[model samples]
Target: MVAPALILVILVTLWPVAQSFYNSLFDYRLTDPSRSERFTQSNIDLERYATEYFYISRDLEDLSAQAPDDETAQAVNDIQTEIEAFHSELIEMDGLEEQYGEVDEMIASFTAISDRDLKYAEVDNDWAEGYKDFLAASNEELIALSEGAPEEDFSTTAGNVAGTLDTINSAVIESNFIGLSNYSRYLQDARMWQSLLNTFIFTIASVAVELVLGLAIAILINRVFIGRGVVRASVLIPWAIPTAVAAMMWGFLYDGQTGIVAHYFEQFGLINDASVLLSTANGGMFSVIFADVWKTTPYMALLLLAGLQTIPGSLYEAAEVDGAGKWQQFWKVTLPLLKSAILVALLFRTLDAFRVFDLIYVLTGGGPANSTESISIYAYITLFSQQNFGAGSVLSVIVFLCVALISTLFIKFIGSDLFEGRSR
Candidate 1:
């Protein structure tokens, strides 16, 4: 039974992480055709190559006939012969001729080759390198001939042929597999480190403030008071609001000229200027942290309240009988008994805070030179905005490792005391 459940857990949790780790091993990017997919071996984009090769052959034939001098004509014929030989060799490979014919038919009919198996054909690494080098040399020669051509038509045709060669060369996709290189590259990236530092600062500052305020709120509301249920319900309103909506609301509140909150903050001497809150790096960081604390503190309070209610009234009474004051009773009785609760609350909040995205994303958008940018935001920009899947996956794997490390530390240190108490 345990084995089956454990297997399910591993499948559900680790599969996506495993996929990301695999992608991080390659130089994958959706924006570039050559790097759109992970290639473990050199491959040819038959669709593109076959389509362009048709035009290239005709263009080179025309150029060779129209060459101004014997030397230019001979150079063009040599380039044409070399390219034709490469194409013949490519089509002669087993299983490629049939696909090449089908791609040729598709091109003739103006149909896109949508099938991957029919589109890309793997080739020997050495052949791919040789073909690419030859294409480069031919292009350079054609470019020189075009520049020095006596007639405008000759120059234009030569330049167009050279451009066609470049297009064909791009169709020859090389293997993008570079194991652990993305990780090493990002490890030395200053922006990555800065984003990480910003994440840590936001997590530490918000969680610390939330813990303190939450504890105080929990203690205050735990005592018998007027309309306690209403108070508790009201306190949860901030947490109950959707985070995006709350962030938008705060954005309005933090606006320099029109926001009441910023106006009040400036009036209270908290800031030198109202516009500083969103215009400066430190202010952007503070703005997000402050918004996060306001949004999450109620949740922390609610968790602590559950723990507070679990403590018996007898403990407090006993402390009082022993001549203990309120603060002493709290330290001696309340705090000691609330250890497990505090641990649970802190662990949950810390992990959540560390991976914070939506709140900060909507609040600051990681702007003001990315002072408020978290690891998640950086990963988002890399993965979606820039469309660099490999580098983005590297950042994601780093976040997972950091979260794992945090969990280990919390369980090893804070949880040890709770487990020991239970054993005792």
Candidate 2:
């Protein structure tokens, strides 16, 4: 039983981390065609090359007609001849002619080329380099020709020639494998460090407040009252709300002009202005922490309340019989007995708060100069928004390390307490 559970845990947790670690060793981005793949050797994206070359050939013929002088027309024709010579040799490689024909047909029909064998072809490293250098020189010369051309049509044709060359240039794939460079670069980045600091501050502050408030509420609701059940259920409503919905709700409440919460805070002098809550650095941090405490405190209370009920009533009776007052009984009997529960509650809340994302994201979007941007939000931007998979995976691995450390510390320091709670 334990073996199956452990295997499942490893598969879910460690497998993704291993994959990310592997990807972080490369320089990969979805936006750049050449560096998009993690290639170990010289390769060609034949689908891209053939399609762009097709356009380049047609554009060069058009450019020769638009040339302002005989000399310029000859120069354009000569460059086209050189490119075609290089391309002819490239297609003559083993099995590439057939692949090129298929790719060109696919391009003509506007079909997506999904076959790897047709899309990419391995080539000699030296030949690939020499070809790329020729294309680069051609591009530079075309740019000069564009600027010096007298006629508007000649200039436009020259500029298009350079751009089409750029598209063809993107077909060459060099090895992007650079192990540990992404990690080293980010370790030196100041913004990354600041985001980590923000995560810690948000986690510590919100969890501390929730612990105190949750304990107080737990103790209050644990007592017998006319509507104790109703009070306990009401207390859980905040925690029951979805995190994203709660964040949007708080966004409105923290708005400057029309928000009741902001207006009251300004009137009470808690803030100098109504708009500052979500618009300033300190204000943004405070708003996120405040909103987190409000939403998660009930969860903490419920955990404590479970532990509180486990303590035997006879212990409190015995303490009272020994002349222990209410305060004395709470300190000597209640607190000592509730230690395990408090530790468990703190561990759970600390881990959850440290990984906070959607709450701060939907509320402030990590704005007001990213004062409230947690490490998770930063990772999300790097991964999806920027499409830099290598750097994004590095950030993700860092978050995983931090979470693992937090878990290790909790288990190392309070393992006995946790075990005791479990036994009870």
Whole-model lDDT values for every prediction: 0.91, 0.89
| Candidate 2 residue-wise lDDT, 90-112, digit = tens | 87887888888988899999999
lDDT of residue 302 for candidate 1: 93
Tens-place lDDT per residue, model 1, 255-280, is 99998889999999999999999999
Candidate 1: TM-score?
0.90
> Candidate 2: what lDDT?
0.89
Q: Looking at model 2, how many pairs of residues clash?
A: 0
> Which residue pairs in candidate 2 collide?
none
Error of 1 at 130 (Å): 1.2
TM-score of each: 0.90, 0.80
* Model 2 lowest lDDT segment of ten: 415-424
Best by lDDT: 1
